[model samples]
Target: MKQLLFVLAFVATGLFASSQGAVKKYRVGIFASLYLDSTFTGSTYKFTNQMPKHILPGLDFVQGALMAVDSVNSNQPLEVMVYDLRSADQSLDKLRSRNTFDSLDLMIGSVSGAEYRTLADLALLKNIPFVSATFPNDGGVTNNPFTIIVNSTLPAHCEAIYNFIMRSNPTANLVYVRRKGTQEDRLASYFAKYNKGSNGSTLLKWKTLNLNDNFTQTDLIPHLDSLKTNVLICGSLDEAFGLNLVNVAQKIYKTYPMELVGMPTWDGMKDLTKPEYKDLSLFYTATFFNTGTVAATNFTKGFTDLTNGRPSDVAYRGYELTRFFIQLLLRYNTQLMQHLNERTYRSFTEFDFRPVLNSTSGKPDYFENKRIYILKRSNNLVSRMN
Candidate 1:
């Protein structure tokens, strides 16, 4: 009788332990801008366009990924608390005051630069991880070892374009055409730095053209002839100016043929499809997501189904961000939170968040850069370039 009782007690203890080991939980906070007013059918939660309804598709993608994670690993179940900031006008205040953070483990936001700064400050103070889908201003939040930027930065895009130009046309003389704007100035500065090397000596020369003032290609005819350059790279974002440049360039092509290089703003600009741009080929650098690769296509399909066909940029942002976070949770479990401060993590777009520390001070100094994709558009067809 004593041996039978001992066996029963041992089995009960094992069963309890196994059950406890099979359950895991994580609390997450989603803070977004609500710019519109609408309600989900049959749900008490009202949604707005403050964050753009189109972004809902991406959000749905993330939800689907999370569900998949939960099914595969019953131990880790995610509890998400969403906060809308349209009415309050101060999302950070709401986030900080919320009782949810007491149990919250991670935060994801698709706010603007100003809002991102507010959240970054809060995340640093609380030692929590905050991921932003868009580019955050450089000075807004660095040094917060926990802040992660999923989108490629503007400067990184500039560098990628510079590198592509150097590698493809090592000795090609170039003419830089730009409108008088801060963006154009920045690109010019980057190109100057890129051409400082030995082989780049006189390899590139630029002629700045202000569309507002110059207005016509005839204004640039003299410079084009004097420079004797056959390549024109545009660094302006104004659609009107871009179209004007393309039109003028096409007219000139009848006499002086030149290849055109452009910035990522040209990606979906309808001006490129006009008859004036037919003879001109444009190339630019963009993150792989914009080009719609295999992974992007699959994600888009899953995202569309989840959002009931409402197309949104936020939806993709939400979906990919959630997918990546879920993967980290599955791989690292509770340890995933700890790895937030690390240098890098595998993302749909390859990302490395490893901190760069000052050698003597032993403090984080900067973030190591990652990869970017280059795209080329010719005759209305866009494709990855090498």
Candidate 2:
């Protein structure tokens, strides 16, 4: 049991607990769905070699948070407690009932779906600032003032995409291409709202092209233009659908001239850099961007040295999120939410946290980082678009 609990890192505060009563101690909880039950076999921990696929994100998050905590040069005692959401003895509800969250000042999570909702509830109940690290959707959480969604939601992505296209080429032949699905319908509706303004005027006209799962070049070529750049925006987050659209567009790009734009989910997709997908330009939006500064470079190097492999973008996000929030927690103390918009604690990306208010109550539902970056990929390289 002790060994299993060790799996959840009890990140030590630098130096011992100070004897002086004047020092204010800060504590943070790193919550992640690291399924430790799969490895704990009758009081014996197995799998000393390869970690399970599902565990990597949580593991990476923990490692990155550790790096941030270790890098802190403050004497202020900052203890980080990692909670495994899937742990049998320490599940979310169990810990919440045991008054675990009451001990922490902040909560950061890489969890989504049910786990996200649970954490949000806990945050609201305890009045602790909760950072939703990776989950884009708010998990239907409402009226939770403490919830801070780090990843921009689907509506936010849609707004970014619409604004980007409108800015670049409002008159350009814009075609919204998507697959037949429920999510596709929701994305389409969001796109339509942008086009159909409140004054009953169409700001921009775009043709919607619906394609099946087995769609080919014949299905996409008809909506594209041959004379000028046919701006094709993929409305679906389905990776398969997105790849097919790009591949089809790539075949006729020389003749039809395509400017490909994809959903925010395409930010970290390595498939877009394949040799076959080269030469064709692709644009996408992301809430987080790794600026690769001196700090970022050192983090990458240090991460590789520790893990003996390169860290994923999530790891970088974890490092930045933890570092920034922890610093803010120490500085502002109980007044952290009041200073959320202060751009002083610059990390890998600039965060613009604004209050999301309820329509009727006119009260904050939650705070969300509205800052999004429009990025471009061309010639096998990805960069921020001006």
Query: Residue 221 of model 1: what lDDT?
Result: 74
lDDT for position 327 in model 1: 54
For each of the candidates, the C-alpha root-mean-square deviation to the true structure, in angstroms, is 10.5, 3.0
Candidate lDDT scores, in order, read 0.57, 0.82
Deviation (Å) of 160 in candidate 2? 0.3
User: How well does model 1 score by local distance difference test?
Assistant: 0.57
Best by lDDT: 2
Q: Go through the candidates in order and give the clash count of each.
A: 21, 0
- Which regions of candidate 1 fall more than 4 Å away from where they truly are? 1-24, 35-74, 87-90, 197-214, 225-229, 290-295, 310-313, 333-348, 352-369
Give a tens-digit lDDT track for model 1, residues 1-386: 12222322232122111124436666566666432223323223343324344534334433443333333344545565555554352356654675445565666776666777776676676666667665534444556665666665666667778778778764554667777778778767877776676865655545655557346766767666533346677777666676677777877776665667777677657767776566576787655444466756676675456444543444555655665665575567546655643433333465545554556667653343346667767776776775
Residue-level lDDT tens digits of model 2 in 277-360: 889989999987777788889999988887776787788878988888988998898899998877766667788888889888
